[model samples]
Target: MTGRHAVPEAIPQESPAPAAAPAQEAAPGFSGRLTAPLLIGSLLNPLNTTMISTALVAIGHHFGIGAADTAWLISVLYLASAVAQPVLGKLADVLGPRRVFLVGLVVVIASGLVGTVAPSFGWLLVSRLLLGIGTSAAYPAAMAVLRDESARIGRAAPRSVLARLSFAALGSAAVGPTLGGLLVMVVGWRGIFAVNVPVALVAFGAALLWIPADPPGRRAADGVAPRLGLDPLGIGLFTAALTVLVFFLLDLAHPMWWLLAPFAVLTAALVRWQLRRPDPFIDLRMLAGNAALSRTYLRHGVSYLLIYCVMYGYTQWLEEARGYSSGHTGLLMLPMSVAALVCSLLGARTKGIRGPLTLACVLLTVGAGVLMFLSGDTPLAVLLLAGACFGIPQGLIGTSNQAAVQAYAPARAIGSAAGLQRTAQYLGAITASSLIALAYGQSAGDHGLHLMAGVAAVLGVLLIVLTVTDRALRGRT
Candidate 1:
């Protein structure tokens, strides 16, 4: 049982009839109660992901490892989530979202406990892997649950439900590092992981009380639900291909040219295999037809890559190069977090991806460009101002990309499409971890930080161009 926060895939196939209810109970906000538990669950994944950024230096110091080696803590988790989220989402569609959601919460609890007492770096990595797998379940399952509720109660639109979840996710992301910094200062680096325990426990109880059970025999009655014939072969090949690709990317600075051979071979095989299957793990043909959706996925990955570089990359440099304590570093980074919260709300109201996403790219460029102008002795006010600019994109990109995905994904494949959207995001996170390691090398410094920012600037420009010129992103039908 694992879940990550994701958009609910599609409308259910069999939406029998809406149940009779009082007028007050039939309103839109009525479904808001269901989001209470789902919101709590949604926070876990993003919180765990970003909170550790503030604590990474402490963990590396404790383990006597370099920045590059300790980066695996970030990379491994994203990698696991990228592969696991879609699979778990499919399971939620099959086994019942409530059941899967509870199980995921339990896994998070166990992972937190393991992390609290981890005696070695290896043990900590294991805890992160478990956490990634477990947290991956929440979003997809919650999405399923939300859709089911909409279906069962006869709601024409559940846009508000998703907005609530999205806002919760971004807000948690904004708070993660600050909360982690406080915990690290109070209870050492381990506190970041330990914190998940109490939060997950509350989420578990709420989920049990709020989320309704699956309508009996939904799966049993649909004897031919695609879950019955999942494409194991396609899944295996895709996972293997992705793993090889990750290795290749992580070793990009090195002369590991030989790795590309296997990566290319596996990727080709995966495409061929998936295309041949009657029900593929990922439908390449659908991706081809839904060009807008594919572009959204790519934009998510690229945008997140830049975001993580700021989150983890900049945090590491502030501590290692600028002599800030973990707590102070978190405090300094608050402007970015706060700005993201404000901008996300504004971005949500935009008509399409072009405006919000372009604004996101512009902000990204401004943030990263500011970093390139700063030295170690640069004013704290100036640095914080740059962070504020960076934070704006944090909120905007997420909501805009999610809206685009929802608009473009086919009704039936919504769950898988949402999962893949998340996968692209995680892949971006993984790429960021790799880039941070490669850029920062043995330790973080101003030079490396500047280089990373330059890379971010380049990405921002590319994203702007794509948003305007790409057919998929230009609001084409």
Candidate 2:
């Protein structure tokens, strides 16, 4: 935590004239002009992730496809995002975050338009792929922008600012199903995709107006020769490895054990190739050295894994097992969303990481344990109470782990580090989906829900152990 406040390498050198001082003086803080655009941009990925949940049925019916075919619509985005997040994040670090951020929004707008006019299911898949790549850029780029702002202001970013980001992401995801359901009812499945156009447009416009321009010759200013060493070969190998790994994870119910062989080979090749490059696509050496940041990634992934399991699994159980309608299930889950929002706001006001993180882990474990007691005969009050238990941890863990990453990552590579953080979360989400499928089989039942909960409880305990044992996080804010 000693260098947690170190100025980012991308910060521009100040001019030696007194006249240039006024411009620096006029620069806005995190809550000033930067807030709206950054928050709006960061919400896109999670919003898109869950928004389609309610629209899947309509989409499958329209395309004359089964659940298996429509399943690709969901898997494709996770697959594309799992690869694109790190790639775009590295680009944000090298090419400048503002430039990358704006470009990503443009891509998002384009994807929305593509989806709106898509002629077939194949075209829709293409749209989702583009959406994944586009949305993946926002979070990492926003983190890099925050780093730049912090360096310019000569202090660490407030925990409240990070909390606002968590709020936006969590809130948008929670509302996505409701929004998608309304959109589908009003304008059909295309509305789900078409909706991105206006949102991206507004975000793009706000970003252009609010986000400061990147200083010229960033690499040169840092005393390195300007070069775009993107390492295409290394990127290819990483993508190949990740794609294979995701395919393997998605098929865990049947266990496609053979895919592991190619995944291992590609990973080995990627490691070997990256180690030799001066500007690797992913800096393995850096990750090896920064154990605290690495742990933050692990914590983030595991936390999200448990959250997604409960979110999707619990919802399905309420619908199929408890015989609740989709509308009723959404209403029942409202308590979770409300609790998460409140806890996120509360968690952000605290400066210490360990306290909230430990509480979140404890609550998550307790919530999972409570899930085992759920039955069709369970009272509505008890169901609502259970949702709130899980929601509290969702809010606390997201902000605390995010703050931990900000505290531990190297200033020079903050963008890439943020990207990898997101990649970990996506991997966790994919794993959750597989776990749900394995447990629930053809339909969500009481036994399957309890089984998933048991696994989540175990992971929750592990998260607590990891959080309490990490000495690096002891005094980190």
Best by lDDT: 1
Positional deviation of residue 294's Cα in model 1 after best superposition, in angstroms: 1.0
Compute each candidate's TM-score over C-alphas.
0.93, 0.87
Backbone clashes, candidate 1 = 13
Worst 10 residues of 1 by lDDT: 1-10
Tell me the spans in candidate 1 whose CA falls farther than 4 Å from its real position: 1-32, 219-227, 471-477
Return the TM-score for candidate 1, rounded to 2 decimals: 0.93
Say which candidate scores most in TM-score.
1
lDDT of 2 by residue, 403-460 (tens): 6766777655555666777788888877777777778766678998999999999999
TM-score of structure candidate 2: 0.87
Candidate 2 accuracy as lDDT: 0.78
lDDT of 1: 0.82
Q: Which ten residues in a row have the lowest lDDT in candidate 2?
A: 1-10
Query: Model 1: how far is 167 from its true place, Å?
Result: 0.9
